[model samples]
Target: MTDFPQKARAAEAAMRAVFDATPLMRNDHLSGLHGADIWLKREDLTPVRSYKIRGAFNAMRKVLDADPSQDVFVCASAGNHAQGVAWNCRHFGTRGVIFMPVTTPQQKIDKTRMFGGDHVEVRLVGDYFDQTLAAAQDHCAEVGAHFLSPFDDEDVIEGQASVAVEMLAQMDGAPDVVILPVGGGGLSAGVLSYFRDVSPETEFWFVEPEGGASLTAALAAGAPVTLPKVDTFVDGASVARIGARTFARLSGVPRERVLLAPEDRICVTILSVLNVEGIVLEPAGALAVDVLEALRPQIAGKRVVCVTSGGNFDFERLPEVKERAQRFAGLKKYFLLRLPQRPGALRDFLDMLGPDDDIARFEYLKKSARNFGTVLIGIETKDAAAFPALFAKMDAAGFAYRDITSDETVAEFVL
Candidate 1:
């Protein structure tokens, strides 16, 4: 059996030829807030803006070293992994065929092309990831090309372990706790395995987006299980199933240590870091920081490290991000209101609003009858507490309204 630590260190050394180690910087803002010395392993600073490049590079390196004539590589991904593989493929002068879902954003596709140049060819396949993956695998077998998994293979896992290999070298001392964002379990499994051998005393927290928590589900079932459905808002770390090879390494991790980050709450963290810290982070990249408030009690007075996984955010989603953040902070709300058609009806309802309330959106849906109409209203308040007072005033004034801010079905169509 191979010693993972030794192989990971070797991989780390090999990666220097392609790109330097990403920064491990202390975050004073997070530290002050948590009353802990918080450091961020900035994997977002990599050449491909993700730790994924390390695995892709290492995996390809091993294959090429074993067989000099092999030059073809294949992978299926819509985001960071595609960029990583594309960038690494160009670095090694290898031919790559990347399969991406048809619905993948053009921003990601263009970036992948920019990274690979002439070294790679991208194929748009199925609309869903599963169909795309199947098409890629089938093509790989047909063409006799090496299939590089996002997280499942041994070499890929070993490549990801290089993250810990770099972190241990960069940190002054052993961190009291390490928080990682989990998707298909490649990075977490590799880091955990490396730390298990080297820094055995370090506590670990694995965070996953609430809507796609394969690791948490796997821990409960004692094996990897496919989720019936997954919300792909956090596209980078929203895997329906944890990779079997990666899960084999992660299976023993305690279920309690796996934290679930709500999609809306992640948007709040994304906005905070971007506005306050001037850091642009994707939903998965912000997962570790999003969980800090929840773990504040345990993290105080301890040295902690949060791995900011990737920074491949599409600026086009900025409006949606702001909307979700505001909603989560309770500063924005949508409601369906029944308003009487009398001349003073709107004036009376407007008077019910607090001083800080602002009507951001207002649209009359339909006249339910000659007396009243249905109105879709979006309100923005200076403080979350303002809603309670505003609601109380509305109640006293005999106004009829239903808060639809949390109604997914209505939000999907109206919000």
Candidate 2:
């Protein structure tokens, strides 16, 4: 009954009032793919469709027990945190003032409202989250309201530890390896703390979006360092800086265990879990699972548990997710080629197609040569190795081309 385990058990007890334990089901698909016993701690099924609710619920509960009549709780978030806070306010019969960036998606805003109902009021302010956060803090100060943070709070970290408590019980014991995604570090920190106390033998694999690998960067530098720019593709786990208190708990962890999941690779995993396993996960939620491919050798025969952080996925982005996945796996490609205008030239090029290759997109820009035209083509194929053969045929046929499928700058503008 160390302090860490005590805190986690208390956190788990508090959460039972809102929602029972989320499922910790063994995933057959993942298990077969990785050659290991794979299980998923489905935090995605939490009340706010994320693990954020644990922190929000525990923090608010503590506040209420102290005063029993705290009026308004203020928070600034346009993602899962906002929804979690709103839901907690409603549950506690307290008022919530949420400040969101004006650019926040209608889906998120609508969900937050739906969760909080009349217990919450949303203020759309600022163009970016930083601005909205500042506004929310100032307002809370002026009104004497408690400004709850998404992370960066010791109480919230303790609240998040509840996930580990449920995981241990649900799994019937400790897992050999626990894959946790690191955002602002509240969930990872809390889970790590709980394991430190009770299951020190368990290994940890900390995952983060490659575009925003704050924990990885900090480990490399031997201290926290700010990222120049962060990609918000994995919004839940994309943090420019790790929490100070959280980094303190996790600072001594081995750097080799921290993994960076590429954004496009994550999109592929998200789509795979959705289609193959009938499980929907946000980009961040898939981070831990996606790293399994990267750590196949290490986890080959071990019992592994990956935290599926959240499922607040917007289905409207499915097409984009598929497009990204195809690009990353080399199942799709874009090329700019020189095409001759001669009568038999187009027919000659068409004859070079491989059996598995499919033309997904084709367009012609202005002719670049007197007797030739610049043609932009998009190709899809069954395998990545098919491209080299396709290119060989195109070269032997005397057609010149450049592959631009992986050129981010070029892809952004033309593709």
Candidate 3:
């Protein structure tokens, strides 16, 4: 345990053969907003657009260095980790079997394939990640291949520590605070371990998607526990259970230090950074940044670093991302309206909309009777405050409506 720092530094040193250290630059935009010196550790800029490569490279390197005859590697990942393993397999000239959920985006699958080229074979195994993982592990045991636990393995944790190793080297001094996005806990565990040893005074904050608050659950239970359900929208960090080995290292963290970023709110941050700073971030990548609002009181006037975790975002999901962001910000809404089947009724409803309100979707479900029709309306406005006045006007004009924007059952079908 005492030699952990040395092992981490060695891993950092070994990484130079594969890729340069990700950038750690002071972000003036975030700094101004938070009243703190905010620095972004741009892990999203890695060759594989994530820090998963660090762990994959290190874990695979150590395995081969220890046993030259061990040439086969197996891993299950739906996103960045798969790409990282594939990339490393190509680098080491080893055969890698990468398993991904059958539902994984084609964009991600393609990228993983492109990264590994001939060195890796991707297997779309199951509809869910757990099934995919089980298959990969079973295959590894049957074939005697090296099974790489994405976050649970010791070597992988050490490799992830390299992020902290580079961070301390890149900065003038230890930052007052370091914000990390928690997925399966490898990155957080490795980073927190290294930082606690090298820079004891540096404070740490962990952020996870609300839909999959594994860290928070673990901290409460005194052990890692599986979440009943996980929202995979922030796929990068939506682990149902935190890694056991990784959680062992992170066990001491206080509950207050663990923040949950709502899935929709993360979309808002993704769009904010993309449009404001011209920095593209996937939902998981935006976790640390999204929690800034919650941490503002504590972080003010402090030198803070936020790890922007990954940028392997599929542009095809841009519209969905935008819609989620708008909904979260209260700038968009969906509702069912009962409209009278009379001439000029549509025009009257349109006229009731404020100048800033725009109808994004207008569809008639069906004419319930000869006198009335049920309509689904999606409205977008410049300000959320405009909603109250619009609803008031509707009430005065005897408009019967049901706000279904937040109704999960209805949204799942119509949205």
TM-score of candidate 3 to 2 decimals:
0.98
Model 3: weakest 10-residue lDDT segment is 365-374
Residue 5 miss distance in model 1 (angstroms): 0.3
Residue-level lDDT for 136 in candidate 3: 99
Query: Across residues 176-244, which tens digit of lDDT does each residue of candidate 3 receive?
Result: 999999989999999999988889999999999999999999999999999999898988999899999
**Candidate 3, residue 171: lDDT:** 90
| Candidate 3 all-Cα RMSD | 1.1
1-415 in candidate 2: lDDT tens per residue? 4687897788789789899899999998899999999999999998889999999998898888898867899999989999999999989999999999999889999999999999999999999878999999999989999989898888899999999999888876789999999999999999999998899999999998999999988888888888999998888888888888888888998998888889999999998999899999999999999999889999999999999999999998888899899999989999998887789876787788888989998898864557788888999999999999889999887898999998989878888
Per-model TM-score on C-alpha atoms: 0.98, 0.96, 0.98
- How many clashing residue pairs, candidate 2? 0
TM-score of 1: 0.98
Shift of residue 328 alpha carbon in model 1, Å? 1.0
Off by over 4 Å in 3: none
Q: What local lDDT score does residue 288 receive in model 2, on the 0 to 100 scale?
A: 93
